[model samples]
Target: MKIVQISDTHLTAAGGPTEEGFRLLVRHLDEDVRPDLVVHSGDIQVLDPDDTADRVRSRELLDLISTPLLVVPGNHDVGMPGLNAWAGITVTDARVAAHVAVFGPDHWRHETDEAVLIGIDSELLGSGLQREADQWRWIEDTVADLPVRKPVLLFLHKPLWSATDEPVDHQVDVGPVARDRLLGLLERIDLRSVGCGHLHRYRQVRRDRAIEVWAPATAFLAAGEDSLPDGRQELGYVEYTVEGGEVTAQFRLVPGMPQITTDDVPSIAQAIEAMTALR
Candidate 1:
């Protein structure tokens, strides 16, 4: 199976260069990397978590892609726990339901002859909510039922960590509590790789038998000093192939997409004010 992973497109209803970047990505997918399935790791929209109109516009724009697509939420698409509240948005059940109402499910599973693809809402991991525990059970049960020989590819919105021992930054990656539980779960599963976005840069690391792939953002690059060591602050997506239960990944920079600095985007406060006005 051939899969393309696109993350952090951050397209907004108010059309701008961010939306143009996604348009370029779709064109590239059509003319070049035409894969069997597209897995959007997250951050499908820009700035607003509860904007149903943004979700509606995103759904319409993403529909331009003809390939089968699956998506999971990012902190931007749905509010993340212990985060975003300062901007006047907090993650609520209705907010998550809003995303599902527009984009299908916040998490899903798909099986191919050679591999199993699972997308989970990473925001739920450290939330300490009932849904978080429920998702863990679902993952464990689902993986337990699968054949031991089948490779499993997991997708989420944030990287596991910059390094295995990196300090926990709740905003950047999974926190300690979620990390410990998730790592324990992976130790028991036949995981081929874990793919994530949210950093805006690209970094890949290997943990025991599984590879962790971080696809670059299609919208912009991470600004100064924000990138992890040995990480590339580039603008692009990832393409991978699964054959004989083995997975190989390639980073394909979307040719000619204009690169924008983080300064070009609105601040959290500005975004919140803008979204409030929209409502």
Candidate 2:
């Protein structure tokens, strides 16, 4: 299954470079790869609106998505809790409703002749505590029922844990409660791999028998000078090919756009080859 993962688009009602990158991404999906499915991890919008809350503003644009986009919301996409009210935008379960109206919902399971992909929403805005608890139970139950021998690709916005040991723009906010619950679930399931996007930079960590892969931000990146020549998050996507219980991938940055994929940018084929060795 050639499933693509794109994250952190930061699309605003007033689109700019970020929006351009999004269009580039959409074009790549519809033309280049024609992935089996496209999953957007989070932060699709910058969330600045005149009347409604930032989350709503972002969803308004999401409604215009040209492809089958599955998504979740990011902290920025929702705007800081209190800030929304002051901005005349309200943050509530309506956000999830709005998201579903545009990009589909919190979770989905798809199986083809190739692989089985299961997704979860990390964005818990409306009905916070209750929603999280419900989703947590569902995630565990869903994993528990999966066939271990078969490969299962799990998708979520925030990572299960830290992306790396280094300090970066990302943080492990899953908390002990969320972390423990998921780890416990993993202990019993044969999770082929997990893909996430909250952290802007690409980082991979392997714990237990599973690989946790963080998809890089689709929007502008933070500097990666000494360690990164691109110095920008650089827009990109994660493409996965799954067969049986084994998975191989290339976390490819869209290669053509000079503004996004530059000379330093890793080619799609190269990126997948790079991560193949990692797996």
Best by lDDT: 1
The candidate scoring highest on TM-score is: 1
lDDT of each: 0.80, 0.61
TM-score of candidate 2 on Cα atoms, chains taken together:
0.73
lDDT of 2 by residue, 225-269 (tens): 342212125457788777666776676878564444322333422
| Candidate 1 global Cα RMSD | 3.1
On the 0 to 100 scale, the lDDT of residue 21 in model 2 is: 72
lDDT string for model 1 (100-121, tens) is 8888888788988889898899
Model 1 TM-score relative to the real fold: 0.90
Global CA lDDT of candidate 2, please? 0.61
Q: Which stretches of candidate 1 lie over 4 Å from their true place?
A: 83-88, 162-170, 265-279
Model 2's number of clashes is: 6
Clashes of each: 0, 6
